[model samples]
Target: MSEENKKGKNDQFGELVKSMNQFFHDKPVKGFLQTMDEFFRAPFPFQSAFPVEVRESKDEHIITAQLPGVKREQIQLDILDNYVTITVQSHELFTEEDDHQRPVRRRQSMQRSSRTIPLPQPIAENKVKASYQNGLLQIRVPKQKGKKILIEGND
Candidate 1:
């Protein structure tokens, strides 16, 4: 082939590669790969697992959790022994329409997250108070006085 023909072929090959790269970038494959990479790079125990902070004082224990986009009624708190578990269930619906006014996509998703924290000391279940405000849930439970236990020797 002549020099001009070789240059023309190389230009066409470059254009072909550029177009292929653009096509892949525009497709969902690239997005999926990015999402997967983020998922793997994330630290263990996903962020949606209801991150909580517990503070203990001389009289009471306070627990606070970050729960955005969740309704108060959707949250459930349970105290079993020295463990406190907070669970939240939520459902979201999303719809998209094209220019023609026809629905192009409809998505419904449900998410549930729970986090259990073991208290350093026992609490007074009857005096426990919980409140939710502005996407934050706080629970205050009074600490119980430590009881003395007698150990009996086995005969």
Candidate 2:
């Protein structure tokens, strides 16, 4: 009687393990899909919506910012001892008009835009120049030279 009871308990434990394994096997694809969805939904904070470029040379540092539909008056430039700042502001405009033949109203929209950039190195104050052309803003900041110090000891 004791041997029969032990055999019955082992069979029950085996059945429980088999049922748990089947549950996991039936939903394997769901588990994998959920993992992939989480991975793709991760946020990217470092990405920029527009493009910009910066270049440096022996004489000066150059910065070119793209502003497709922006105007010259919408931008500002600020310079300091070791850095330069550029700021652009955006404005919006809306228009509505009625056609003579159809009497239908049409709507149009526009957005104002702005951006700023800070230079890595200080530039020569007197030699800085800036200009805008063909929707591109360019700045040339001349490099400043450092003065050398001479020390002499008493003879």
Estimate every model's Cα lDDT from 0 to 1: 0.82, 0.66
lDDT of 2 by residue, 1-155 (tens): 69899999999999999987777667566566655675578532122234568898987788888766667887777777676666665544434344655533343333333345566666676788999988888888776676989988897
What TM-score number comes out for model 1? 0.64
lDDT of 2 at 134: 86
Q: TM-score per candidate, in order?
A: 0.64, 0.49
| Per-residue lDDT of model 1, residues 1-155, tens digit only | 89999999999999999999887787377766665685589633325677799998888889999987678988999988888899888776867688998986676667778999899766567889999999999999888887799999987
TM-score of 2: 0.49
Instruction: Give the clashing residue pairs of candidate 1, or none.
Output: none
Error of 1 at 145 (Å): 3.3
User: Candidate 1 lDDT (Cα, whole model)?
Assistant: 0.82
